[model samples]
Target: MDKPTISKNPTKKVASADHKNLSSIAQYLKDAQGSHKRSIPPLDQWQPKHCGTIDLKVLANGEWWHEGQLIKRQAMIDLFATVLWKEDDTFYLKTPVEQIEIEVEDEPLFVNQVDQIDIEGKTYLQLKSTTQDLIIVDAEHPIFMRPFKDELRPYVHVRFGINAVIQRAAFLHLVEMGELSENAQGETVLSLKSGDLDLHLGT
Candidate 1:
């Protein structure tokens, strides 16, 4: 199934904050974002000081929570996502002034939608996250299975050491679009291709 592309607007203001603690962080991000001309921030150029940790967490299911309260506004989440930065194994919400550590249960993002697009004569799989990040299934953005709980779950590289968990529905979609075949080791594997990039869905 084809999903709509990510929005190009970068000037959307964050939604009104319901939690006082989150409001402070949200305000800092908003102010730091002064005029967001770029769709994604230039996180590489930003080297802000560490501002300690916050009560923010991204749950395994891709829901964002702050101070034990679920963050329900998509605008707020999108705003926060623009500043998402990964250093080593820790995830942080970064700004021009400072960076604050946040906990991520699994991957920091989730692929909620998948689209199969025929570009010219080649078939390509496009994955979209809840925060409007689009990742093409290719060598640079390969999908691999990771152990979660007792089962293996699919994940894909997003950008700069950040990965997105493939939601079950999206994983099933990829399975339906994949080709079943035997690998070199005689093990059955479902293979998917995007242009010249080939990947085994789940072996």
Candidate 2:
């Protein structure tokens, strides 16, 4: 079945009065996000029955929305980000108790920053996500670019099949780090090396 069509802007601009109850939602977000830290939930090991879909949707820019209202709390976004998983092209919010599907406008997570590290002369790139998760770009977690509208956008696999969109600034960093090299077939290519793994960005 086809997924529901999301509006151009996933967050609809409701009347200002709609925000009168932000306190309650903020508290709910804080409770969910701040409730647990130190250790991540074992979502990979979770085997729960699939629950019905929810109105939750992750926007292309990494902001979240519920029932057309923006989820403006960073703590809440961080909380939901922890439980996110992707099966094929579908995104899910899973805990030990249950799993429910959610819509994603673009890539689920947004990678806003990138930094390079050197370990015994081996360089590795680390990605910092808006959700405060750090990921290493390596063979297991590689970078890719796809056409978005008229331009190409880069993304990297963070974890559990969740792809993080490399934003403008980080995209520039990745490009600056790229080196012009040759492929196995001696074809000219542009690639980035991280931890002894050379990922071809483009030819």
RMSD of each: 9.2, 6.6
- What lDDT tens digits, residue by residue, belong to model 1 across residues 128-200? 9988898878888999988999888889999878999999898888888888888778887888888789887
Judged by whole-model lDDT over C-alpha atoms, candidate 2 comes out at: 0.74
**Model 2, backbone clash pairs (residues 3+ apart or across chains), number:** 0
Model 1: residue 167 alpha-carbon error in angstroms: 0.4
Best by lDDT: 1
Q: Show the lowest summed lDDT stretch of 10 residues, model 1.
A: 1-10
Number of clashing pairs, model 1? 0
Per-residue error for 143 in candidate 1, Å, reads: 0.8
TM-score attained by model 1: 0.82
TM-score of every candidate: 0.82, 0.76
Error of 2 at 184 (Å): 14
Model 2: runs farther than 4 Å from truth? 1-39, 180-189
